[model samples]
Target: MTQPFLSIRKLRKAFGAFTAVHDVTLDIPRGEFLTFLGPSGSGKSTTLYAIAGFQDPSSGNVLLEGKSLLAVPSHKRNIGMVFQRYTLFPHLSVAENVAFPLRVRRRPEAEVKRKVADMLGLVRLESFAERLPGALSGGQQQRVALARALAYDPPILLMDEPLSALDKKLREEIQAEIRRIHRETGVTILYVTHDQEEALHLSDRIALFRDGRIEQTGTGEDLYLRPATDFVAGFIGNSNFLAAEHLETKDGASTIRLADGSLISGINANGAFSSGQKTRLMIRPEAFRLERGPTSAELAVEIVDVAFYGERRRIVARTAAGQEIDIRPTSAAMASQEATPRHRRVFFDPGAAFLFPA
Candidate 1:
């Protein structure tokens, strides 16, 4: 197997008495897009800074290509960084901004010009090379920032919420541009973001952080579908969590009783959950279906609210137990069930439900 390009071994950081990052470790493969996802103050940014050598770790080692970077200076690390703000020099033209790093490296003027032109073309902003930073749009300025980061031909790039300053449409546009540049250049990236959708869309793998610790790390689908912990299940996406009591296991399948006295049979227990153990059944909003099958568990609910989301309809239902459940149905499925009144019976398949020990 090939070794990872970046290896973080038991990395830790603390501010005075408060530990910002606690024994975090991860391996980022070469040319892979890895994202650190979490809420504010979750240590995601701190970890990124530590890896970039901007913030010293309280303990542990950061290795790049099997070499420890403990004594390396920030500027000498040769890692490229793009922050939330464009950080472009307002006084310099786009071409000069992209050439800043090459100049710092004392490259010959001829070579710097060639590299700056290539970088601008890579970002599809070759035409804007002569324009000053103030003359370009926010998105264009960010492209310049990206071009500048790549000017020196760094092996790894670190982005800290780089797209958060743009509007929604512009953010998406830049996201695609970033992906394109990553593929074309084959540069490994360590991206940091709090947006779940962005992380899911951009990362090859995601490290979900919480309270200065890594809660879980997996592919987007793994974290979304087979979450290892309840925190991950709730944090990754929308879920309907129903309380249940574990029952007997038969033939590797475990049975659980719901709050409404409904029996739900699902895969085996995740941990050492035994009979009578408290559990929570997790089901996505779109997992439930409205059907008339007799074998399916029925719910007595009232449609309290409805929202049309182009491709699907979002329905908020209040169960007889007074718990609110969110359900999403395709436009066709919703049309087929239009005959049902506001207060109606809804049924869902047990196979779609995932039970997790609470």
Candidate 2:
């Protein structure tokens, strides 16, 4: 078997009496884009820092292409990094900033000049080569930072919420540029962010952290559609988790009794559930339909609000048990007359719903 391009073995980090990262074991193939996603203090950034050698792990090993990196100094590790804030020198021109890494290694002047030009062009900032860091917008400064990180042609690049400082529009614009640069450079990237949509958009795979350990890791679709736990379902996307009791399970499908005394069978169960065990049903908002199908179940709800949202209709409704749930259906599925404050029956396929322990 070919060894993984990058392997993290039982990586852990602690600060005094607190453990920031638990034993995290992950393997990444060369040139893969992986994101560490979680909320604040969840250890996503801490794990990235360990890889970047910002701090030594209390225990465990970090191996790149089979060699251990623990003893290597941060500057000697030969890894590139971009951070939440642009760390460019205010007195340096964009070209000088890009060339700094090369100059540090005492590369010939001609080589530094050529590499600087290539890096600037790669980030589409050739026109701004002479511009000072203070004159550039937040987004452009970030692009310059990206250029600097790649200027040395490192095998691995670590990004710690590099786009968090930009406005929404500029953030999205840079996301596209990052994707294009990744394609063109084929650099192995490990990014850290708490934004689920950003992770889903940019990553080939995501490792979601909770507390001090990884909750789940896979493609965005895997976590959204086949979540291993209730936390995974709630974090990856919007979901309506209704209270229920597990009645029984047969052939991997379970029957559940909802809070309002309604029975729903054929739900995709996360694990074998015993009869009479309390549980919750997770159904995505988009899964709810206005019309019922042969295999779908119905829920009686009182419409609290409805509004047109371009191609989809946003609905806020309350269940018979007084639980408010969100529902969004395509405009084509909802007629103008049906968009009103009244009692309605929402339909959803049992196969699309997941049952988890309460």
Candidate 3:
């Protein structure tokens, strides 16, 4: 196995009495785009800062290719960073901004100019080289910022919510650009963002953080389809959590009795849980199907709201137990179904539900 490019072991950071990050550990392979995803104040930004040497961790070590990064100065770390806000000098043109890092490193003038031009071309802003930051559009200014970060040819790139300030459409455009840049440069990237969709779209793997600790780390599909904990299941996507009590296990299947006395048979609960323990069964919005079949477990529900979302209709329904669940149905399916039924029935496959020990 190839050695990982970056390895964090028992990393921690604190502010006096407050712990910002606690016992965090991760290994990032070379050229991987890893994202730290969480809500605000979840320590994603703090972890990025620590990696960039802007903030020192209260405990643990950060290693780059097996070497300790403790003694290395921020500039000497050779890591590029892009902040949420565009941090370009007002007086400098786009080309000059991109050339700043190379010049600071005392590279020859000819090489600096060549590298700056190439970097500008990489961002598709070569024509805007002479334009000042104030004169450029928000997207253009951010492109300049990206070019500047690449100026030093850093092996690792760290982004802290760099697209959060941009409008949604522009954020998506830049997100694609960032992915392209990562591919072309083969530079390991550590991105921090609160948007789950953004993380899902761009990252090769995601580290979901919560209250200064990493709750789970996996590919987007892994986290979404098979969340390890209730927090992870709730945070990644929409889920209807049905309170259940473990009834019995036969072979590799476990039976759970829901609050309404419905028996749900699913794969065995692999985690630590005793018989008769209270748990929650996680079912995604799309897991349920509208069908008339004797084999399916039926739920009597009333359609409370309907929302059209182009490709699908968002149907909100209340079960007999008064638990609300959202279902995404295809437009064609919604159109074909009866609209006047006061009480509707829905069925879900047993394999689609996940049992979480409460």
Give the best candidate by lDDT. Answer: 2
* Cα TM-score per model: 0.94, 0.97, 0.96
- The global Cα lDDT (0 to 1) of model 3 is 0.88
Candidate 3 versus the native: TM-score?
Answer: 0.96
lDDT of 2 by residue, 1-358 (tens): 9999889889889999999999899999999999999999998998898888988999999999999999999999999999999999999999999999999999999999999999999989999999999999999999999999999999999999999999999999999999999999999999999999999999999999998799999998888888988999999888999999999899989998988889999999998788899888999999999887999998989999888899988899999999999999998888854636599789999998999888
- CA lDDT of every candidate: 0.87, 0.93, 0.88
lDDT of 1 by residue, 1-358 (tens): 8877899999899999999999899999899999999999999999999988889999999999999987999999999999889899999999999999999899999999899989999999999999999999999999999999888988899999999999999999999999999989999999999999999999999999998899899999989977777778788889988778988767656788877786767544556568899988777788767876554656678999888898999999987677899999887789877665888877766655667878
Clashes of each: 0, 0, 0
Sliding window of 10 residues with minimal summed lDDT for model 2: 332-341
Q: What lDDT score is found at residue 333 in candidate 2?
A: 82
Rank by lDDT, highest first: 2, 3, 1
- Model 3 bad stretches (over 4 Å): 249-252, 267-270, 292-296
Error of 2 at 354 (Å): 1.0
Residue 136 lDDT, candidate 2, scale 0-100: 99
The best candidate by TM-score is 2
**Per-residue lDDT for 124 in model 1?**
93
